[model samples]
Target: MNSNFSLPNQKSKAILERYASSMSTSNAVSFPMVISHGEGCWLTDVDGNKYLDMMAGIAVNTTGYAHPAVVKAVQEQAAKVQHLCFAVFASEPQVALAERLKKHVGQDYRVFFGNSGTEGIEAAMKLARYHTKRPYFIAFTGSFHGRSMGALSLTASVSKYRKGFGNLVPGVFHAPYPQPYKYPRTAEMVLEHLEFLFKHTTPPEEVAGIFVEPIQGEGGYIVPPAGFMQDLRSICDKHGILLVADEVQTGVGRTGQFLASEFDNVQPDIVVLAKGLASGYPISAVMFKEHISTWGAGAHGTTFGGNPVSSAAALATLDILENGAMENARVQGEYLLGRMRALQARVPQLGDVRGRGLMIGLEFVKDPVSKLEHPELRDRVQQLGLEHGLILLGAGSHAIRLAPPLVLTTEDAKYAADTLEKIILEAASH
Candidate 1:
């Protein structure tokens, strides 16, 4: 650890001042460190202070920072052609990526590329409504789809995200997401609530799609009870509603499986993937089953959605994932989970430690008995993490998320576990 280091050193401070003057205030700043560059699972600030990166650009860096293969692919693609709008012209890289996605999905799903997860969600919304001719949709409380008007309506993770953005898209209703840690038989409870919604509020026939996160990302990294997704699939099948999996955070082998939904053996009607698709490059894919691709060409298109360079990078990323990075995520994830759970046993304030594969969450509470959230302690842990040369981020209300790059090794995972244990101990004492 860099004992002499402090955040926002002179160089970082200067850059931050310039950023403050130039950038929009709406942009949320989680940490003060000004990064110089990153490699593997580590980042260095402008002041030359090194920090172990656990968040991985909010779970976007699948192959870690500037992996050689991804860089070479990007360079080669850029040398050939940067951008030739896929809407007007066919590109080899884009078509190849689409084919790869289809193969990986193991389904006859058609792909639609977009610039962000929100755009993918927006496209899914349009396709769902267009195909079903339905005006209503169902999402869950504490879910975050995105910020666009259509996606925002389905986003209920944070109230502030929707505050003042009134008159959101109509016909979107929310159901309670099951958190087994807090409430037992939460799957049954949520299913009962959905049934109630169908009976009292929204008609089953009018609902277009059911938007869900396989493992609710922003919602405290909450993992639902077993069979919850399978139950949802059955419900969707019964109601003629499309099941849309928002894999923006949990997709691309983050949760051991290529798709977290695979854990439950459920295949969603629509799947939206982004974040780690191109290892931080701007690209998202909204895939729907072949039967659901009812929209005609030109109905929805993006000029730069599937840029050649990004597609090449994605192909390289997929190669790495297929070869070994993905399996590394599984092994290291289990190792980290065991380390944290052991620590949890000794720490009273560490309320619950839950996750699947590399996508994990450590929830803090005032006490384990009551399990009351300790947001202040969570905040302290995140802040102190910076001083300890560990980069961290919080998810939901009182949980710290561990979403490091898929390239993380067992040794690095040990470093993260040890450092986080120290941070948690200090934070809990305070």
Candidate 2:
């Protein structure tokens, strides 16, 4: 591995200066590498240095950067017709993409297209309230739905994301999410907490929906206990509350299945998908059971939601995922999990390693027994990864997330595991 290249070389430094001056400070810029382009699982900065990308733009690029199939689909659709307001005119690409979503979901459902995951969350919120005529919603602590007012109201992952944005949308309650690694019987505790909330705080009859992530993404790639999702489904069903699954970071074969909820054999009343749906093209979909399609025309609409080019790109992405990419995620994910667990035996500071498919997290702790979070160590490892020609991102308080592109090869996976082992060993020593 070439670890000698200087980051923020002359060419990249010039662009970084321009970016600092032009862009908003709210944008989180983790590294100094100014990317010029990417192919497969690697990115090239303007300085001509290459880094293996493990975050996949926060799990956005399912097929990786500049996949030929996605490029061709976007080009062909743009050449014919680039934009049409789906609210007014029906586009073929948009209709076709919706049809494809129905098949993957394996249900008779209606799809609403938007430009982002937040928008999909917003749509689901609106639909839930409209269908049930309820004024309240329930979400989990350490869940990230989105940043818009309604979606923000449902998000409880980071305090900074909510700071200064006071008085968000009302009627949203938060319950604890089950983290089995940290606390045993977490599922039972969480379920009891929800019951307490239903009795003491939010009335079950007034609650419109319960929003959850199958595998918590931004909060940490934390997977819930085995029966947690099924329990949630039962709770929602008993109370006539819609169960909304925020699959933004875990969908599109990211978890070795089309939807992470599939692992538990549970189906949500509403499913939100984005991020990897279009290979980084900006598009999201809110799919709900057909029975809940009660809103009339003009109730919710977007001018740029179903862009033809993005829809075509999503269709192509789905085709690739269905063919073999999903299987590859399963195979490589098991391989990576085994490798990391083996390393954990020798590296006592690695408190926990948990994930499904490529959506994995490695948590750092001061000691294995106490499990005190070691955020500093996690941050240092992320920085050192950049120096070693590897790109990684941090999740939750003290965990490094690995949401690499679904196209990651066995060779690349092996290299990533080896490089991470080296970086962790160095970080732990310090």
Candidate 3:
């Protein structure tokens, strides 16, 4: 391990023990750094060790940590007022944020604010059912909408997430998402299966909407074959079903595009935005086509939705993304992808490298010929790389996702790629 790399601190260990025994009912998993602050793409621990932030707080810090623009916006907004419920009264930050979003939406759309991606999903669910007056929804296998009751009912990634939480929200049906690599299911085949499901399991007339991620995030950063999203749009159009694009992880320049769904040829009726939308602020937007925003007052509401501070932060995030961060994602993302693919020649265990822009996934395998997943090796590589000042995150069981900030420079990209290659080789040898 490097000298700057963190070792297990007794102070942090004691704090963690006390946290576990005294803290809340929710469980949390964290590395042992005990981070004190973040700047740009680096994190500083309380003990003064520094580490590159490769995952961007799980793709939340789109403009990087403690971004000056976002911090300034927050400070300015907080100085005036922090909490003026938008539902009760109009606020400039929230109104401006909504208007700014309108310009980017490219179509007539209405915005609804909430605190997180799950809230956006929940709102989308209600809107879909209310608009279509239907009883069923269609989701895909390996999809992770969220952990909330409604979103959890739609999620089907890991059995552990659903275990012990039965009797979930009903009317959600699951279909297979095209893996392209694993089991090699073509888009047509997946759509055919969906048709079979509609014919036998649930009628199309009864389905309120079909929710899909443009690029599967928790399902291992899987990118569907070309024309897959267009086909989905066609299917939904034919059935009068709303197509909800869950862009929680892929939105706000993560995919080198405003919305990964836009990478497809069609427009979704509803688009869910979170994660990178407000830098690190807790805010989410459920954007819907004007025609689909049919519900009247008292239908759905959130107290913390469109908080002034969060809205200000979101506005700053948008300014950064639109001005240059988005283009940077495109260039740096291509650089990172090409470099990783180049490494595959020597690192034969690198099975598949895929993604758009910054949301890249590198899958590890036992060997080139066998192509069996090597999750254990992947875990070892991540831990060792973290100890070497390179941070990495896993997707699915065998893949590592590089969802870095849009501001990531070529030097940072090179360092992370080199460290990852070295770590992978070390893990393979072990």
Candidate 4:
């Protein structure tokens, strides 16, 4: 073998061995190739292999990598003032970003800035507890809130995530959510379970908030049936419990809309956003209705939550998402989902294809009759994409998630569909 051809791949392996953690992390179905650079919807590996990125850093990049407007805004903001520590000195960028986010939330809403989705969830939890003077919360099973203790307490997606983390935050109760593909339960049944929970388990009077994902992200990207959120909202209102939407993955135009909750006409009492808010910058927003403003000063504070540079990037990201990226999502998502539906009819392993906008999920099963989840096949299909210079991620038990950048074009959609078809067909044969 020629040494030149092997050099690039070997260098990546070497760097990973030397600097990266040894613990095996198999979340992304990550390929061995080291990324050299990224543009709109593509990433080039160190070995010069170009991959169409369908994961979009797990629905974080709203405007794509190194977007000109976002980059320029970040550069200019950094030159002016990178760190004003919003707690100490009021930052113009922070205030401007808050003003922009305000319109998206609603007229009578308040914004709390943080650095990640989990932090936002934490804030929402605190605010709910403080405002309601309640000690309990209701979180849906098969949901991924975050990894921190407080948020993790609300997360019930995978048992492995909470296996050994004993002494997990208490005061959190889990209720089943509707999953058509995996479970036989319907929205009505889930609502009944909530009713049972309120009666038998934790009393609604003691519950502060009910946390939910507008479109469940890690739990197979499952989107509950119509009227689910509406029913849940009514229940929350009836009990004086806050309805909290964990929009960390579905917010910021990932679902072809500003918020996935918007589609159901269900207004959440609190909205937690992060992933696409600043493209790739670390920023999370916890927006709540104005009525929950019982929080006083010194209750919560972060030193670097509202960094000026990140705020500028967020402002730029919103500009792009509103101007063009959102419409692209609205159009291209339909095209991609249509192709996937056609493919689903032809492929036996493809058990289900469902999602809204760009946040699609392609679920795999062992066979049509059994309908048993084929997680192995799902992993193989993901690996096949990586081997063929395509980037994608797996979610839940046996589903591949497609959450490409909002800027994905029709051409990109065609390429993704074609590539997925090729990959799935080849895997099926094996």
Please give, for residues 163-204, the per-residue lDDT of candidate 2 as tens digits.
Answer: 999899999999989988776757889999999998898999
Candidate 4 lDDT tens digits, 290-382: 888888987988988978999999999999988988888889889988988998888888989999889999999988778899988887888
Instruction: Write one digit per residue (lDDT tens) for candidate 3, span 1-430.
Output: 1122336667656666666678665565547656789998998876677889889999999988888999999999999999987768889999898888878775599999999999999999999999999999999998989999999999988988999999999999999999987768899999999899999999999999999998999989999998899999999999999999999999988888888987876789999998898998999999999988889987999999989999999999999988899999999888888988988777888888888999999988988788899988788878897778877888887888999899998888888878887787788787
lDDT of 1 at 9: 79
Model 3: worst 10 consecutive residues (lDDT sum): 1-10
Give the better candidate number (2 or 4) by lDDT.
2
- Give the total clashing residue pairs for model 1: 0
List the candidate 2 regions with Cα displacement exceeding 4 Å. 1-8
lDDT of 2 at 263: 91
Q: Estimate each model's TM-score.
A: 0.97, 0.98, 0.97, 0.96
Regions of candidate 4 where Cα sits further than 4 Å from its true position: 1-8, 20-29
How does candidate 4 score on lDDT?
Answer: 0.88
In model 1, which regions exceed 4 Å deviation? 1-8
Q: If candidate 1 were superposed on the true structure by all CA atoms, what would the RMSD be?
A: 2.5
For residues 125-144, write the lDDT of model 1, one tens digit per residue: 99999999999999999898
